[model samples]
Target: MSDKILIIDDEPGIRSSLRGILEDEGFNVQAVASGEEGLALIKRENFDVILLDIWLEGLDGLEVLKKLKEEEEKAQVIMITGHGSVETAVRAIKQGAYDFLEKPLSLEKVVVTVKNALHQKKLEEENLILRSKFRNKYQKLVGESPVIKELKKKIAKAAASKASVVIYGESGTGKELVARLIHQQSSRKNKKFIHINLAAIPEHLLPRELFGYIKGAFPEAASDKKGKVLLANGGTLFLDEIGEINPLLQIKLLHLLEKGIIEPEGSLEPIPVDVRIIATSQVNLAPLVRAKRFRDDLFFKINVLPIVIPPLRERKEDIPLLIDYYLDYFSLELGKKKKTMTSAAKKAFLNYSWPGNISELINVIERFVIMVPEDEIRPEHLSLLVEPRELQLTPQNNHILSLKEAILHFEKEYIHRRLMTNGWEVKRTAQELKVTPQELKEKIRSLGIRIAD
Candidate 1:
């Protein structure tokens, strides 16, 4: 569609001339006789640019501009007048006018200004789209369970403040993901977000890596270097696995957290930093503090806002949703056809204990997208990757059971396994067990076996 331009002026000759020029420039031009008419037209239609004369019959151009600002109109406005002055141009610009033009307007300048305004508008729109995409990528938590909902609330409240945050979760439970979400929603989102894993860095060189030294400070110090603290000034610094830091490093970190000052390993002067600390730990710091392995002061300083992420096994109800999300995600990412899982396969997934948590689940789905060739994934395909926990009577438990109770337990397990293999189809399972469908249904009800939808 061609760009739409609105020409608002009282003089018939000026409106006609402006309309002709804009139309010749391949723009869809609409000319109006008064500001009131232009405002009414804007209410019904949208335009890319508005050319408004300063002097109108009832409502002046400035007043119309004020109304547009109140409505938050997206179109760019340019001011035109026969009697123009520097003061008028500055005021118009302050009021959000794209440009100010005199009565003897240069048609060439008009085209250039309008094109520039359009370009600026396009860039602003693209910027908004990119920011939205970035937000969705980092801010999504992908679960609707009660625990997850509460966790999101905590993250939002924590993001609004500048206090230090400490996240607690098991490995593969997305601790760093929560930290990134907090930073993305904070006031300093436009600034840097620096992350360093304490567990990944070597203990012998951690000090130099964190608090960089000046040139000639050491034999290998070739030039002045900025540490993570200094580099993350006015932004956020995420310390992953903060519990892994040694005792000496913990003391230095405590001093920095207390004074907001960082002293390089060999530097004489201490530089103050303005960094928001976000730390994560798989282990509880309180026990470590009691054991004298972690400094109490440092632990307290970084634990102002605490957030805990629940593991996948605890939220089994949300497993189906997570499976669907990852299946679609990996299919699109790998440019493969999305596959469906058989009832047996889904039952297997629900039966397994996800000890590795969401990270493990995501990897498993991605692997299926790349390796599984069939459109319908079955239990055998999944068994290649992980063995689903099955119902069994162990020797220890069997010893405590009566003879009749043991026989009933074995019967239940056998029926349940057969039903699952046949995708919960009663007739097929009954045929395999040499019984009628009605009898099989009665046995299922007596054994209290839950069927998967």
Candidate 2:
């Protein structure tokens, strides 16, 4: 669609000239005789840009501009005048005119100014969309399981205090989601929420990445940089996979926790930071701390407000609700009609152990919504389950092992296949095998099975 331009001028010649020039440039131009007509059009329709003359019949251009400002209008307005002066331009700008143009307006200048204004409007619109998405992602925690309800109650309490939080959960168990929820619900909701994954950063580059450096701080420190702590000042900093951080950095981090201050590389001055810390770990930190891999004192400092999220298997009742939620979400996202699962299909999903958790379920839902042409998802549609069950063993191979060995081998293979199908969600896989999650973990360890990425 072409850009919409509104021309409000008293002179017939000026209106005609602008209309011709703008239309030729592929704009949808509408020329009005006075400010009243322009205001009426603005109320009824949307325009990308408006050209208003300073002198109009009933209401002057400045008055119209003031009214637009009061109404919180979004279009970019350029003031047009035959008697242009520094004072008039300044007044027009203060009244919310994007730019001012005198009579004998240059066609080139008009086009350039309009383009710049449009660009600025586009950026603002994009920012609004990003913020909306950010809000929607952390606005609420999904599911109605008892554990989920308990977590919500704890989150409210945690948000009320300024103490550092340490969230413990397995992979794909919504640890980061909980962190974001805390930030969204806390008083720092309007401020930045910076996240850094300790596991993702290389050991050699960890210091530079966490505590940014000044120019020539190191061989590769080309210019000055602001670290996550400084960037998250007056906000929250999420340190994901905190156990993966090396011991040296842990000491420095402990100091930062004691006194909300940071000294950038090659700088001696301490820069105070008012940042809230939210850390997450997938493994038990106590074991690592016992092994001297993680600092004990540092652990105590961050463990002030601890939150532990149970794996999905422990809350099996929420599976159906999660499935329905993902189905609706994916259907809308993929622009397809919402699909329903057959009772048998739902049962198959319910029985299967989900090794991957909610993230894995979402991927499966997206695949079914997009790939399956039928509106109903049946048991046959679940290839992850049906296909794996088809694996067979020959009598010649079966005779090689004792009954006990054959059972162990079968159990190991069955559990491994289910884990792969569910993206390695141990709790879900355990439920499928009719074994405790701890039993499945031990079996996986005993059988020497390595999960594929």
Candidate 3:
């Protein structure tokens, strides 16, 4: 079917001209003499794009746009008027109008704007479908541990409400996963769930990235840019590592939370948005607030619904279950038979503190599935992967060793652990260890540590 276009103008000539133009462009066009008629027709049918006139008989274009938004209409509206101003255009955009146009209308500009609006509408629909499918694929939170059960309860509660949430957890403890689960189960599940890592973005560029900017906002800004916050309007914005946000940005964020509006760069107009913030942080914000690094008001605002995820070390009981699940999952994913671990190796895994948490465990399991040829993974196979903290050193033995021997022993163990964590990449491990690769190679040779080719 051809794309449908609805024209709402008080002037018969303008309506007829727009209808003719759109119809000639292969659109199924409908013309109405007033906004009232256009709205009535919208109630009866669906249109891909609506060409609305600012000056109407009963209801004006802005009022109609407001009604369309209130009704949650999917059609993209392009507002047109013979008398147009920057204020009017900003007002139309703030009220969710796709684009603003002036009359005597440039027919070519209308066609291009309408096509762009239709294209955007199609992309949004496709995104919703894709998000639905993704939500269906990974809806459940794994593990039957008591902490996990309690976490699930909190998640369900958070989902049922439209409150800001701050998820506190260590790195790799699935903070993002929990955030996504909350978004998936929330009232806004059908809308977009945009995730922005505050830590990943440079501090200088963060405001523009989150709040967007108008055309020519900066030297490099050649066109208008929609930020993640606007993109997540009527949905959830997952601010990953939100603790990394600077003091200035925090104030802006606080303003957004307090007032449901954001001012794009280079524009005085503040666009109203309905965005629920779901922020994840590995660090506690209280200390940052006390230090004056983070805004206290902002912290309190976002901490309305605080959900703390226990690190894997605290929930060691879930290790076996996670191991089984990942083993089965990675085995199937890698097209290999399921692998089993010896009781001793499992004991070592449970004993070792997984500083990297669930993510580290997953990496180790995946590595084993790919590298280990045998179905039965033994303690020796885990030697390089698992840190030797499992082997407790007696106080008497420590006293027997000299200072140099103890230093050498600790250095070797630490280097080996770092190597294993970095997949034995000498360059990466050296960078992390703050040493030159050549120096690390010398240490590795002197220590007689074996590395896989």
lDDT of each: 0.79, 0.79, 0.82
Better of 2 and 3 by TM-score: 3
lDDT by residue for model 3 (37-131), tens: 88766654557899988878788888999988987888999988676365786789988999888887888998899999999997998788576
lDDT of 2: 0.79
Model 2 alpha-carbon miss at residue 324, Å: 0.6
What's the count of clashing pairs in each model shown?
0, 6, 0
Give me the runs in candidate 1 sitting further than 4 Å from their true place. 1-139, 386-453
The TM-score measured for candidate 1 stands at 0.57
Pitting candidate 1 against candidate 3, the one with the higher TM-score is 3
The best candidate in terms of lDDT: 3
lDDT of 2 by residue, 365-430 (tens): 777898789999876566543233335443465467679877876776677677756545678888
Rank by TM-score (best first)? 3, 2, 1
Ranking by lDDT: 3, 1, 2
Task: For model 1, state the Cα shift of residue 104 in Å.
Answer: 30
- lDDT tens string, model 1, 1-453? 477799999999888888888899999899999888898666545577899888888999989998888877778998886764657766988989888788788888888888888877767755864676454432458888899989999999999999999999999888878988898799877555788999999998888777767768888887566678766766789999999999999988888889988888778888776789999999888999999998888888989998999998888777778778877777776789998776677766776556678887777777777778987788667533322323235446446878898788778767867765665567887999999989998897787664321
Candidate 2 residue 273 Cα shift, in angstroms, is 0.9
